[model samples]
Target: MNVFEVTLQPASLKNIVIIGCSGAIGKALVEALISRFPDASIYGFSRTASFHSLEKKPDKYQEARIDYEDEASIAKCAALAAETGPLDLVIVATGILHQGEITPEKSLRDLSAEKMMALYQANCITPSLLAKHFIPELNKGSTSVFAALSARVGSISDNALGGWYAYRASKSALNMVIKNAGIETARRNKSAIIVGLHPGTVDSDLSKPFQANVPAGKLFRPLDSANYLLQTLLQLTPNQTGKCFAWDGQEIAP
Candidate 1:
C-alpha cells in the first residue's frame, strides 16, 4: 500500500534530528520536514562542518559536524541536539555503498576483511551508535520514532539473487541492531517506535551506478522517497516497531 496516499493528521513534532544530513535522501527529508513543520526545529549532522541551506535558516535549522568514525563527535552532537528539547524523531540516513576503491563484492572470492569492515562501519556501526545516544532523548509520553535507512537486500528471507556480500551483510546486521534496540526502547518507553526503512532505489549518489537495472517506477526521486518514508513513519505504532518497512509501508522480512 502506498502510505503517502493516506491522509496525514498533524503530528506533534517539535524537534527532530537527521544524522548524515548531507546525503541526497537526508537533504530531501530535511526539506520535506521544513515545508511540513515550519515551526519545528530541525537538527542536521554531516561529516562536513556545515550545511549551507540549513545554515541559511538558523531559526528553524541547526547543523553540526559528525564523523561516524569518532564516537565522541556523535555523542557531542547528540547532546547538543537533546538540549534543544525532547526529540520527536531521529533518522539515521548515513550509509555507504562504496568508498575510495572498494565496491561491493560480487562473490565470496571478492570479499576482503577491509572492505567488509568499512561496510559494517558505515552501514551498521554508525546507525547503532546514533541509536545508542539519541534513542534515550525521545519523548516518553508521545509517539516517537527512530529509524535507519536499511536496504531490502538485508532481508535474509527475501534474498533470492545473491551478491553484494559486504553491503548485504552489513545491512542485515543493522536490521538486527534496530530490532534489538526497538525491544529495549519499548521496554523503557511504550510510546517509542524504532524500525529500519527500505527507501527503494532513490536517485542519489548511492544508487546512481545501479539505476540502469531498476524498473522504471522503482527509481524514485529523493524527495518522493523522503515523503513516502515520512508518511510511513506517521502510520507506525509501537506494535509495529521492530520490523523493517518498505517505502510503501509494507514490512520487509528480516
Candidate 2:
C-alpha cells in the first residue's frame, strides 16, 4: 500500500504517546496524531517538553519531560500515561546520529568504545526500555502498535558500503529488540503489533550534514515523514509485526 494515501484506519485508535517530542519528526508526529485522531489523547514527551512551542495545541494533548537515558524517568512517564487510559500507540522517535562530538565513523580506526556505548544507549537501550515499560500499558483488547525509529542501515543482510560501525550496529541491536518485543507481545495480546520504522532520511538535524549525498525526491519533510510512518502503522496487521518497514510502507528485509 502507498503509505502516503490517507487510508481509513481499521483499528479504533484512542490514546497515543510520542517519545522525543522535541525532535523534528517527533514534533511533527504529535501534530499529525492530533489532526488524524482529534478525539484521542496525545501524550507528547521530550527532555524539554517542547510541545508547548507548538502554535496550535490540542485540548487532549499532554506534554511532559523525559530523560531518554534514565530508566526511572521512562518508567514514571509510562505509569502516568497508563493512569489516564490504555495506550493505542507508542512511538519512540528518539535517535542519535550526529550530535556534539559524535559522528558516523568512516573506518574502524576511528571507532571509540565510549562513542559506541553512547550510540547504543540512545539508539537501542532507550527504545527497548520504553517498550519494556509501555508495552503492558497498550490496550490488550484491541490492536495497538509499539514502534520505534530504526534505519535502513540497521539490517545486517542489507548492509552494503558499510562504514558507520557504531550507529549501524546500535540500530541493528534495536531491530532485534523490536523483533523480541513483537514475539513476547504476541503471546500477551495477539492483536498487538510491534515493529521498527525507517523514516527515510528526513530533513532534520539528524540528516542535515549527510543530505548532500541524498538523491532527489528521497529526502522528506518531517510532517510528510510522520504521516507516512503513521500510514504504515494504520495498515500493518498482527501477521506483519516484528518486521521493519520504510516510510512508503515497503518492508525492509532483515
Candidate 3:
C-alpha cells in the first residue's frame, strides 16, 4: 500500500504547544495538527501582535502572545496553557539566524563580543530556559514529547563544511542543553521523550540563501518538513529521548 493510503495518522496527542508559531515550520505544523487531530487543542505562540502572521487559520488553538527573549512572558504563557490540563507535546520552534548586532561576524577580522553574546542568548539560552519552565507541565504518567528545532551544523562531528560560526556554535550548545535535560527528565518522568530535531533546509527566510548549495531534491518545503517531523515524533519510543534526528528520519549523531 502507498504511504498515504495506509491511513498515516498521529496517535491521539490531545494538547500541544508550538512556540514561534508565526514562523514557516510552526505554521505548517499547526495546520497539519489541526487537520489530523480535530479534537486536539493546540496553543500557538508568536511575538507578532496577532495570529494573522500565520498563513493557516486557527481552529482549535488559541493564539498566545509570547516573547521568547523574556522569561516572565514565557512563564505566563506556559502557566495559562497548562490550565487546560496536562500537555502532551511541547515544541520549541524558536531560533535566530542573523542580526547585525547579535550574530558572529562572517570573517575572522570582524568578530565582535556583542554579536557572539546576542546569538548565544537567542539561539542557545532561550530554548534551554523554555525547557526549564515548560517541561513540568507535561503529563507525568503518560507519553509526552519535548522537542526543539536544532540544526545539523550543530553536530560537532558533522562540521566538515564550516562558515556560520555563531549559528553553528549556538545550536551546538542548545543540543547539549537538550541532551542534559533529557537525562534529568527521564529520571524524573520516565514517559517523557525530549528530542532535538533538525528540520533540514527548508525554503524560509532563515535558510533560503544557503539552499543554493543544497541539491535540488534535498531542499524541503515547510509543509513537507513539518509533516515528516510530526511523523517522526509520533514514531519515537521513550528510549529515543535526547536523540537528534533530521527531518528525513535519519539519526544525527551528537
* Best candidate, lDDT: 2
lDDT of 3 at 182: 87
RMSD of 3: 4.5
lDDT of each: 0.87, 0.88, 0.82
* Error in Å for residue 200 of model 3: 0.6
Number of colliding residue pairs in each model: 0, 0, 0
CA lDDT for candidate 2: 0.88
Provide the lowest-lDDT 10-residue window in model 2.
1-10
What would the per-residue lDDT of candidate 2 be over residues 1-254, giving only the tens digit for each residue? 42223322544778899999889999899989888888888898899733557777878898899887789999999998878788889999999997799899999998998999999999999999999999999877677888999999999999989999999999999999999999988888777888999999899999999999999999899999999999989888877779999998999988
- TM-score: which is higher, 1 or 2? 2
| Residue 98 CA displacement from its true place in model 1, Å | 1.4
Q: Over the stretch 42-156, how does candidate 3's per-residue lDDT look in tens digits? A: 9998898756444555567788788877899989988987887888888988887875455434667666677677778888899998998889897775788889999898999
TM-scores for the candidates:
0.94, 0.94, 0.91
For all the candidates, what are their Cα RMSDs to the real structure?
Answer: 3.6, 3.4, 4.5
Q: What C-alpha lDDT, on a 0 to 100 scale, does residue 174 get in candidate 1?
A: 97
